[model samples]
Target: MISKWNYLPLSPEQDAIKKKLVRELSLSPVLCELLVQRGVTSITEAKKFFHPQLSDLHDPFIMNDMDKAVERLDRAMGGKEKILIYGDYDVDGTTAVALVYKFLRNFYSNIDYYIPDRYDEGYGISKKSIDFASENDFKLIIALDCGIKAIEKVAYAKSKGIDFIICDHHMPDEDLPDAVAVLDPKRTDSAYPYSHLSGCGVGFKFMQGFAINNDIEIKKYLYPLLDLMAVSIASDIVPITGENRILAYHGLKQLNTCPSLGLQSIIHLCGLKNRELTISDIVFKIGPRINASGRMQSGKEAVDLLISKDMEGAKAKSENINQYNEDRKKLDSQITNQANEIILKNCKDLDKRKSIVIYNADWHKGIIGIVASRLTELYYKPAVVLTYSNGLVTGSARSVQGFDIYKAIEYCRDLLENFGGHTYAAGLSLKEENIPHFINRFESYVSENILPTQMSPQLDIDINIEFNEITPSFFRTLKMFNPFGPGNTNPIFCTKNVYDYGTSRLVGRELEHLKLEMVDSRSENIMNGIAFGMHEYNDHIKSHKPFDICYTLEENTHNGASNMQLMIKEIRPSE
Candidate 1:
């Protein structure tokens, strides 16, 4: 699909700051320009960005109700009261449960964990879990990744003599639950310095608070839990800035150097043991395998795998989870194809429709979210994929970059039985009969609210650079921007007036990848560029036409030698 190229413009003052940074850091002007674009105007900011330290993490007590949560946990542990760690069934939730449960088990053995069944209880705090805790005589429950919206559930648990300490990162509603302590940085009243923490990050802060209050060194727990935090942050797609960046940076170090037995087993299983793993590896390889367990059968199995102590046990669990991942992939592909066919058949003019909402009663509920996300890639608009579950129409919603899908769904609240989510994604449910009305209402809401520019995909170019600027040292400096994600994204540089140097070819199994050697128009300098899944552009390169390209620089190693190459993002005919 063609995307609009958005070249970011910098002010004269910003240009001066970039020049100063180039001189002070002894870096290329392009690297300095990217740093400036990321808001690193000074040497100190650049240093902090390049070298993220765990000491830079904010005090956990800064979060509202953190102290209370820690104290409650301490009191429960001291009295030998049965405590339960309750979490959702996704990567963030399961990882949060594993992190806290593993850490607490080192000192307290009375604590247990519970992951609600996705099909039986759906997301968040479930009455079934509260009933289990009550039957098991648990006095305290720590809800991870979810519970901010569990007002009625918390009240029910409270009525059953169970206290709740919620560690959620999702935006909370105006009326907070009556839990013993609600630890959410997104709370309007929270004083936490960083609010973009993942659900596992919030749970880690609770552990930090507990350590601080107990006078135990926080590093003892913090260091060991970093891998889990890193995985959670990467999988949950939280903004990798501030404390999240520090956590991911150090966590990745730990993950690469001394991962948990479970992580090591999975890495070995995926044939990624000897190589340095990136955030992409974690997101695509590790995250999916872990999520597959919950998506297929039970998330508790994933939590068990993560917290496994022995290599043998971890490997055994990893093998089983791998099968689930295989099954998940098949279902995902099949459902996505079916959903695409539905969209194609139902909507004759996709551009005219502001939204895409399709329902298949036979669709697997677990794969609908993935299907919805895949649909957005094809249509470049807000998409909702629904399936029948428990006699109700439930589904997931995914939005494009500039749209607030949650608000759009909220606007059709009358048609929905219930719904909740943030700006970009959400979940909703309604009667099967309401599907038509809901789809029409949702489309109308989006058409009225969404800007025309938001309909198409966009590629944001950080700066324009010459082929000569793509040096080995420049690529090395770019590598310092580790653990890239939402906030700190890999910089995309555009080079204009370039043509293929007689080495363009379509590679990959289906010839879906474009590989070419590009030559600059002015200086005739050359660089290799690869555009994955852009085989459609082979003809233009074959014609030897000048084109502008946006891409990111990466170091490619072959035969023990390394050099920089451009990972192309977009290509456009030169004006």
Candidate 2:
């Protein structure tokens, strides 16, 4: 599919800010422009952005109910109460559970962790888990990455003499749970300065507050667990800015230098043990392996691997999780292909449809989110992929850029038994018979709310620059913008008048990728680039034709030699 290129040139005000920043920092105008775009108009702000310090994170107690949460935690440990660490089934949930459990285990002995089975318990705080806690004499439950909306369940736990301390980042409903403490950054009355924390980030803050309250040193106790925080932040797709940046910046350091045994084992299994890691490595490689355990089997297995103490045992567990990842990939591919076929055959006037709601009872429930994502990528529309699970139609929904799938799902809440998620993604369940009504309502809502630009795939080019502008020093500065994700994305540069040198060729197994040695009109330097799935443009590129390309710069290592390589996003023949 051809993509629309969206480039916004700097306005006068932005240009003024960029020039002022350039003057103050003595940096390239382009670099200044990027900084200014990120709302860093001053030199101090730039320094903080590039050099995130752990000390700069907001005071954890500033969040609403944090003091109460910490107090309850202190009381639980003081009384030697059997504390249960509860979390969701995904990467964020598992990581949060692991982080909290690891920290508390250092001081407290009467503690255990629990991860609800995805199929058996569904999402969030499950009644079964509450009952299990009650039966196990778990008097206090510290719920991580979830439980902001467990009103009835928390009440039930309260009746059973179990108190709840919720550390969650998801948007909370108006009526908060009657837990001992509800710690969510998104709480309407929250005083927390930064609100975009991942579920695991909230858990980290809770731990931070707990340590501060009890006079525990943060550097020795808390900093070491940032590896888990980094994985959670990246895998959960949270904005990497403010406190998150500090957490991920240090978390990555912990991950690279001294990862826990389980993470190290998984890193070695991923073949990423020797190299420096990035957010992409976590998102694509480590996170999936961790998530696969939950997707294919039990999430508790993931927490077990995360908190493993033995090296050999962690390796064995990593191997098991890797197999689950492999299984998940196969299932994901099959389901995505099947979903595509269903969409193409049943949906007439596909372009006219504002959203997609496809149902297949035979589809695996665990992999529908991936299928929904695939549908959004292929069709460029909000998509819901549903399957029959225990007499209800349950599934995941993925939205295109700028569209809020969660809101769209919530708009049809009367038809849904339960639903919750962020703007771009969500999960929902309803009566099997409500599928048709859901499709219509979801589509109508999207049609009314979604902008036309959202229905088309667009690549937002950061800036235009010639190949000569990319110097070693420039690339080094760019590398300082590490740990990029939703908020702080890696820059995308567009270079025009690019010609493929004679050495360019098709490199992939099916000859479906362009491995290009490119040079532009302004530069004599030959640039190596890869354009994936763009084989149709290979001949056009190789026939001495000049084309404009937009790409993000990445380092490619081949046989122990590293060089700058452009991961090209789009290629358009010069008009």
Candidate 3:
């Protein structure tokens, strides 16, 4: 893998532009400079950065069927009608189910939820789900994380006199189904200002309006549930700014102080020793365990854990979730190794192909997307991983920045039987025979559109400074950019001259990491570093050449000993 290390390279034109913004805004040079760095060069743009508000959210009634959907839900709650929620089996889907499930459970005792079995039902709303909704006497049905593509199933449910309200964020086709209300910002008719909400966020917003119309206390009832929305936002890789940023910020605050019983148990299980839990903790230490349930079997168990009221129920579910996570780790490693071997041997046109569309009839459909995501990161290209079982072909696609993988698939829609997803990720199905044509045409579309320069990942450097700038206060100041994710990123600082001047050791049994010390008495500060997943380049680093290092400062603690350390991201021989 080619590691990227970016330093803020300045030009005369850029400096002049920065000076102009600094003069016009009457803002601190630091704030103005940062905004200029972000491509905002005037006070009009600066107002947006300095003042963030909830009024920025789009009008709730502007979505295609928002009024009708909210009206149907209001009726269900008022009449004590049995309400059933259906969702798919991923982190986003499960979290969406939890949000809607808990929100409705607050108002009515007749609320219940269902998540499809990954192996048995595959993806999206199924005929079985509609059948169950009708038979159970749930006059009102809410579909989360899916159902935008279920044309036939929605019609089937409508025929049974059940009202369907869809809360999905995927790209929509020209023809919508016959649901009572379809809520997707991706639709052409939607006037929602921000089109990038996680599935759970959409469900939460639906509840936000429902609470307002019903004259319920929204903060007391809804805000505490944001922890689930936060997890879904990170797990689904949604941009974490605007409404999402506010939701995640409040969600972390809630988890740190007062959390749901299920979340509190999982928090203790994950070993988050600090009371200050950020988005990183949720993604790295926790989200995978909740997701492991759906990936291996049924996501219904996860929803059970989220809504479990009794302490014993929460404990048992947490223990099972932890074990599932362990199993996921083992299976993921095996699939990654096996898939890599197959690609190296059989993918002859890899260099020439635009998007990777690989399928194996014998491969496990449950793990193909995970393996496919690994492939995209390795090659820096759009990737599609597919598997076949019972005469049906199901596949998942992941994309790099600046390329819309969903749009690429739309170019070949005629060849597909069913599909739904957003800009960077999507899921689709087809006849087993269409694989070859898909591979050819999809690659042709990518090759024609993606420029060679654009194929390289965009490297963003927050700000650059020498090792002399290292301090506890400097780390403290960087907290202004907290709650980082797709929209906000951790600051990457660069120091040009550093000498390893010691043996570089590869750590871990698989040589998964590198550890080394760089001393520079020639400069004002001294430092130690650990570069994760960089053992592949140890031989080149052992030679005596000064290196440029990019890293984030982190505090290390062990046995009451505490000091600053470097979480080295990348290293390059000095230019």
lDDT of each: 0.89, 0.91, 0.78
Q: Report the poorest 10 consecutive residues by lDDT, candidate 1.
A: 468-477
Cα lDDT tens digits for candidate 2, 1-575:
76899889988999999999988998888888888777888889999999999889899989998889988888888888899999999999999999999998888889999999888888899999999999999999999988888899999999999999998888788899999899898999988899999999999999999999999998989899999999999998988888888899999999999999989999999999789999999999999999999899999999999999999999999999999999999999998888888888988888898888889898888899988998899888999999988778899999898888888999999999988889898998999888889889998999899999988889998999998889888888888888899888999999999998789999889999999998999979899999999999988887999999999999888889988899999999998
Summing lDDT over every window of 10 consecutive residues in candidate 3, give the lowest-scoring window. 48-57
User: What's the best-to-worst order under lDDT?
Assistant: 2, 1, 3
* TM-score of model 3 (CA atoms): 0.90
Count of clashes, each model: 0, 0, 0
RMSD, one per candidate, in order: 1.7, 1.2, 3.3
Error of 1 at 314 (Å): 0.7
Off by over 4 Å in 2: none
TM-score of each: 0.96, 0.98, 0.90
What's the lDDT for residue 325 in model 3? 82
